[model samples]
Target: MPFDFIFNFLTNHSLSFSNPSTHLSYFGSRIICYHLPHNSHRNLSYRSILFLLTIDTLICQNCLLNQQLYASALLHSKSMILLFSLPIIVLAYVLCRNIKLYYDLHRRGLNPQFDIFGIKGLMWLDSSAAHENFTRMCSVIGDKTFSVLRGATPVVVTNDVDLIHAISTEHFDCFHSRIPEVLSDDPITSENIHMFSAKGERWKRLRTLTSYGLSTVKLKLLFPTIETCVSEFLDHVNSLSNGHSVVINHSHSLFQNHTSYVLARCAYGHKEKNHRVNNFLGVFSNAFGAFSDFQKSTAEKITYFFPEMRLIFKNSFVGHFLQSANQQKFLDYLLHLISRFRSRTINENNNKPSEKEPDNYSLLEFFFDHHNEKKLVEKAEGQIDMKKVKVEKSISYQEITAQCKFLSVAGFDTTANTLTLLFNFLAHNPKIQDRIFNEEIKSHSDKIDFETVCSLPLLQNCIFETLRLFPHASPLQTRICTEPLQIGKYEFSENIQVVINPWGPHHDRDIWGDDVDCFRPSRFEKLTEQQRKAFMPFGVGPRQCVGMRFALLELKTTAFRMLQKYVVKTTLPVNDSHGKMVNMTVRDTGTIWPTDKLGIILTKRNT
Candidate 1:
């Protein structure tokens, strides 16, 4: 009891002691006494004794640590030096890399760099004012090729036909892929990647399969589907006319409806107007915002600006896209179709699919035939996992969904707007309309077949000329240099975007003579071989629109037939609100639309 009491008394006294004072020192040994304050420790309970010991231990440790810290602060350590230098090193590296890029592009690379830098080039994403500005600047610089900034990214914009051919064909390997859209790298989000966004082997595989499937021979399978839709659309217009010329309000909407129906039949195999049919039309309209000006979602904008943030923004960029309910449904609907395709093709004896039906051919099914897997479609009854569907040698479910969705929409705004421009032009210029009809369509036959329309040169030239004047895809046509690309004396670095406005060459006086502004289709005849191949409305070379033949077939056929039936008539002058079709060009995010509703009259011919 005495030992315990003594121990507790001394420990509690140490806890209340002031800083230790050295009394005597000899060699390294020293006698230090901690002077205690006159304090009371009357509570002699076990808990009180334990608390005093803990406090005394902490005070002793604090005194030792302070002395060690004082010594460390005076001596320079390697870790401390690194801590101070790391940030500066990183900043210097970035600055040096940018400086090298500038020297490589401007001085050594012979690229005439424009002064506009920073966020000014983000106009390409905004897709309007900046684009128009770039087009104007092309003239100010007075050169066919120049370098500009797309939000600090270097973009080599060119209108030189010879250089374009070299990049697109002669030296395609140097500039094959496009700049990616900064999508999620989530394996499941691979569904959002399409042929346009793919790189390397994936691009080649997708391109090969789709190009063959969309060939003339393969597309012939869907001729009846296209024919029926086109005929029905014409009939609907006839009904709306009431046996007289009628100004079709918002003609693009009519074309949009027609495109939806076409996709419903061609992509989903929905022939009838079934309300519950899986047309996949709602997927675009409800989910991705369809033909209208689809403002990018906040998640999309964030991902685009900060691509490294993809991990955080993955869910919003692809797969379900919860921000839009229809996006989930759209993907699920495609998987369901794949499930059904599996059931019909599979022999039911094993996991592998069986024989394919000879007539089972559609844009969506074509992809399934070429590249398909079963896991994603496991839950045909409900939503299924988007991942776990990777195949060793074929395309995936998302690729099929994305590519077919792209093919289906090719006719919507692009084809529709082209037709809109064509009809409007014909209505304004009666002489041109009469000449085309009397010379091309009527000259062939009262009801010309598609094969016959394809042979008509005059009608083709008119359509080509209209596309030249308003190349909707001009602003969107772009390619990322894959390697060091050299065209004549100039060279480009990898990741440099080879862009074109098309508005330049298409309207250039040097290229098209002084009558560049004139409504002349005959200029195409005078153009050289290279100049003739330069009319790239759908883009140029191998990377051109996969649905080009299909779109062109529909365009030429529809234009020919429309001319055959109705004489395009308009009472409005050349420059009314919608009358000035040229001024009404409202291009946004690769879509060319008009500012207001387009009003054009379709007068039935007295055939």
Candidate 2:
């Protein structure tokens, strides 16, 4: 037999070596000596078989020992890991369960109230808990006194009209805008004309600047620019229609473009040629993508959990991008415009130029005039720091730019969302849509003037009802108390945040009656003269939306023009999901755009 065959044959037959000790001894002695190869070929073959048997025996013995050792280590390691992590996991589960239980209990009239320490107490009024928890808080607390939330923060929850009016209007200075950590953390937020800014002098100065720059007169002057943009928008829509039914993403590209163009033109006196297809819309789209990614990170969750995360991550990718692109663009554009306007004004002033002026009137020009007046006052008073005054003078340019950018973002998305809601409502309630259409037709003569458009009472009512039922900035308004103040029987100390739940108030049965959820425009019509004062869609008091007029005009004008041109219909079954809206401004944040699965189809209307 071959040497290999002999080795295998011997190894297989080795099982017959009955005594384990005898087998080991024979293998070791033969295997150790046979490698010398001084004997015959049979001796060599026997030696090779002995060597193979010895190696196999040793490997088997080692493997058996290792297997037992590994099993014992694995069992011990598993038990230790379980022991270490079990309590932590259990604690997390218990806390989450308690939160849910507390929320549920509050929702169902249990009225269990407790306070835990820290800033996380704001979580009680956060959007996640607002719907149920806030409602329960309002019912149980009843505006009698401010309750301290878990995190050592005091909060006042109320639906009482007198108390709300007192806090929002009468003693407005005592309970000014909320100072959110997000706003205070970023320079853009700190420097901008956000609604969340401090009250009194700072708010007064900013508000005055904004009013001058974005005033009704200014908006009226800018109307032609908006009209031109909207005309282009209509053309784009017509081109897209192309005789075939098309599914359009209304909130994304189309609205974004129109809005960007409107802002660029109105704010900077510059309009990009492909604003609808490129420019700020693209920037916003990219920024939103980056925002979504950043939001997914554990860092984002931590930042949300602790406001101090904002301090650490002040230069977050999303925040920086927003400031650089949106904030910086507007700032630079405004500053450049201001410089040019100031140079031209200086030349004109020296020459005693006529008040008739040039065609390129801008918001910057208004600001320049306002700044001059302020400078004159400071000069006469002799209390001015020329350096600080110079800085303050440049503020208008930056402030107006910030406000304009905010309008572009806030006004655009909210208006589009409101329009979507209105259209969805009309799709379901054809009668109401028809009423609006008929009113528009009746109101429009050969030419529609501003006064004629404004005169349509029913149209106004329809718009009001749509806004009330589906307010775009549903839960956006927040305010922090700077000083201890009483609202009804509740006394809220300084640093306590108050959230004005517009959606809750709008949907409240006590406020709007049992049919509050229903889309009944007649409800607005039937509102007693006294009741109308409490129904604030644009909010109330001095800190109310500054761009309310502009937004209203845009919405009304768009609705009227669309009604004049086309009758909107939906191919997809008109459902809530198809017309779902989101609250962008307030406590919660998510995909606020209407889904692609839902949309309205428009057909030409006969005059």
Candidate 3:
């Protein structure tokens, strides 16, 4: 239509603006014209007519050329304007965002803070002394809630017990999930989802279902499983030391294997020895080791300071590291356990008259049976649903697998680290070891059961103090605010990162006096209510370690058995090495452990 309009307008150009003698015609899709007015065509020579026609054509061409030039000039001017203004607009936006963030943090009592670049917040990335650095910052800042940029991510590190209690419990709805759920392509790896990673309703459901397994009654039933493993652990240690002082450089490995064996029996309901079990232990060790390495890496640290690089880290090396073969193997082992348990359930159902004892139910079987009962309840309720919405109340097989996997890793790693640290402490302090063995544990040697061992106050204090001094989980809890809330005088907005520094309070001079760092198991004997609450080796509040009860039972059981039979000391060069005292240091993986290859010497007790 535009072409037609142009053609028609051009054809009428002579009539509109020039003499009528010049006429235009459309012929063979081309414009042509001729003049024949008053028969004067002969007077005007052919060259003259041709010259006139050329002049007219030039006028039309000039007009079109001017129009095209005007449009091109206008477009170029606009382009130039945008090019110059774009950066200014972007800079203005960034400045506003930074200003808002700064003001928000300032209002919350965090001022003079590091920007997202992590100039100050990157201190925690220093694995050698991250915890100490963080504490130093806490002391210097004189604020319980101080702000730091983690690679551009804003993190509020807190040492205030009240604030920790508030965020972790009082305002739990606003601060629930930790890191965003990592999506994995492998089904087994995906099964890594459990209470730790779950949020909202899913977390509630999973926590409730698994809580049954760790209940006092349930733990009482499972005590035999724990005792058996504790017995085996003592035997292993005896064999390893051979009634002589033997140096153990890898105490983590020793305790880790012990915890894994106990978890295997209680959680998976299997006592059979298998290659998969060893592989399973190695899988977690490798995965966690890799994760710790990744967290402490330059790339990950930089990402914290510069949040923009998170995608790059996630898509590149760090991302692949998370989905390591160890992770896959861990997932596979979980799947295998789930498969075995489900198969057992099928066989049990088939033999209806054979009435299996409830005491024999493994953690997995309980979850499965509980889920079935929940489904029946949901089905019955749905029959009278007012909305008629079909609610899927049945738990997925993957969910069950994830819960098992979570319990296995969380329970095993933290407990193993604690036990290792405890043994190291006892090895270095033979006086304390004697107190634990001859005083605390010897009384129960005749009938060493869960109740009897747990009844020993000194033994309990030993566990508590060991955890306090070397809380395996230093920054015990980390959370992100999901909604706006205030902690004390400080205001928090959504997505703000919060961390509870358990190590800080545990070692604070003011809280425990000048000798706060000293290994004093007696401190726990008369702890104030605040001090007792402040001592959170297993964390505190609703999101505190769900398996805490079980972990304690496991720890006491192991400690009682080992201290009953052995005297632990350090062979490392230090004063009072033989009598009881020994120097100790720590190395940080994800969680702090005794420095790698730090040797602990164990000798059989002359009972």
- Who wins the TM-score comparison? 3
Q: How accurate is candidate 1 locally (lDDT)?
A: 0.62
Task: Give per-residue CA lDDT, model 3, range 1-607, as digits (tens).
Answer: 4345444555556356344234322221112234345545446643454445555566678889999999999999999999999989866765666666777687777553756435556556434456666678777877766877654556788888888888777777667666442222222224335677765545555666677667888887888777777776766666665456566777778788888888887888865654324655776677564323234555555555446756677663566675558667777877887788778778868887687765565788777765642332221100122133333434666677777876776777778877876776666666777877767767664467657856888878878987787666664478777777766678887777777788788877777887676667888889987787689888776677888888888888887777766677765653322212322222323466555554677777675
Q: Once model 3 is optimally superposed onto the true structure by TM-score, how far is the C-alpha of residue 37 displaced, in angstroms?
A: 28
Off by over 4 Å in 3: 1-96, 116-129, 179-192, 243-245, 274-277, 291-322, 348-353, 357-359, 372-394, 573-590
- What is the C-alpha local distance difference test score of each model? 0.62, 0.55, 0.66
Clashes of each: 0, 7, 10
**lDDT measured at residue 20 in model 2 versus the true structure, 0 to 100:** 39
Local error of candidate 3 at 576, Å? 8.4
Q: Write the per-residue lDDT of candidate 1 for residues 1-607, one digit (tens) a residue.
A: 4336535655566545442221111111111113333332332453544445455555667889998997887565767888899978856754565456566678645464643332444544355443455567777877777775543456777877888878777776666677655443422235556777665545666777777777878767766666766777787788777667777777666665666776666666654653323255555555543332225566655554344556676655452463456665765775676567556545432654665443456776666656655333211111112233232335677677777555554555687677777776677778878888887767565555547856777778878888877777676677877666567978777667777667667766766777666567766667786567667788877688887888777777788778888898765675322222455343423555654455688998876
lDDT by residue for model 2 (92-190), tens? 754665466455435433343654332344455543434445556666766422343433333445444565667677766665554454423432234
Best by lDDT: 3
